[model samples]
Target: MKRILKRRVLIPVFIIVFGLIQFKTIDKVNMVVPAEFGILTIETPPKEVGELISAACFDCHSNTTKYPWYSNIAPVSWWMKKHVEKGREKLNFSKWSDYSEEKRDSLRLKSAELIEKKWMPIISYKIIHPEAQLDEDQRELLISWMKK
Candidate 1:
């Protein structure tokens, strides 16, 4: 009887707490995405190359973030927003033109090295976004392009 009473009290309290928390939310800020930025701003690679880069890199590296449905939830949205903010801080690809030639070149080289070593597009990101996985061909292409 005591355990049952405790469960009854806790469940409703948990639900009420969760329901109240739902009031806070995040919005999609698609308007801020740069219309004409990304890897293309650096050079016009082949269609496949550009596609591969955009699929894997744009979400975090650029201002153009195509958020998934879960991004609307408060805590999850907050978590994702934190990631996006952190990613942009490390490298905002949308503003690629703003980078000096040397800085851009160094960054490109670093990106390629990470992909070649399978360190980038980190595992956590790949788990949620399967499309971002780089096949052997894509990996080789990026590595070769960076070497150039």
Candidate 2:
């Protein structure tokens, strides 16, 4: 009798807790802006190079990210939000005009170094966003542009 009562109480408690957790997860999603990178660099690269950068880097490292369907889900949305926030914190292409020349140069060098090491875009990101994976030619284009 006690076991049956305990089970009844535990089930409802679990359901209530789960509901609360799902609700709490909703707040983790950061508000997205309508505009993207207004100005990604001090000097715009050629159109081809610009496109390459957009495909490979802009989603995370810029002011804009086109959230996919999965991004609407709870934990995934939370994780993606944090990732974009961190990425933007590290390098916000949208804010290029705000950076001083020395800062831009330093960031370019760092960006190049990360790309050379195959550390940028991150593995998990590439797995889900295969379009974001940079081919050798694309990599070269970005590296060259950064150096320039």
TM-score of each: 0.84, 0.78
RMSD, model 1, all Cα superposed?
Answer: 2.2
Per candidate, the number of residue pairs that clash is 0, 0
Q: Give the lowest summed-lDDT range of ten residues in model 2.
A: 28-37
Ten-residue segment with the worst summed lDDT in candidate 1? 30-39
- lDDT per residue (tens digit) for residues 16-134 in model 2: 77666566453334345433334444476799877777887888887656788877666677888788888988888777776788988998889888888889978889999888889
Tell me model 1's lDDT, rounded to 2 decimals: 0.80
Computed on alpha carbons, the lDDT of every model, listed in order, comes to 0.80, 0.76
| Candidate 2 TM-score, true structure as reference | 0.78
* lDDT for each residue of candidate 1 in 19-135, tens digit (9 for 90 to 100): 777787765584474546555755777788778878998887887888998887767887888888888788887887778888888988998889988988878788899999988
Model 2 stretches with alpha carbons more than 4 Å out? 1-19, 25-41
All candidates: CA RMSD (Å):
2.2, 4.2
- lDDT of residue 83 for candidate 1: 80
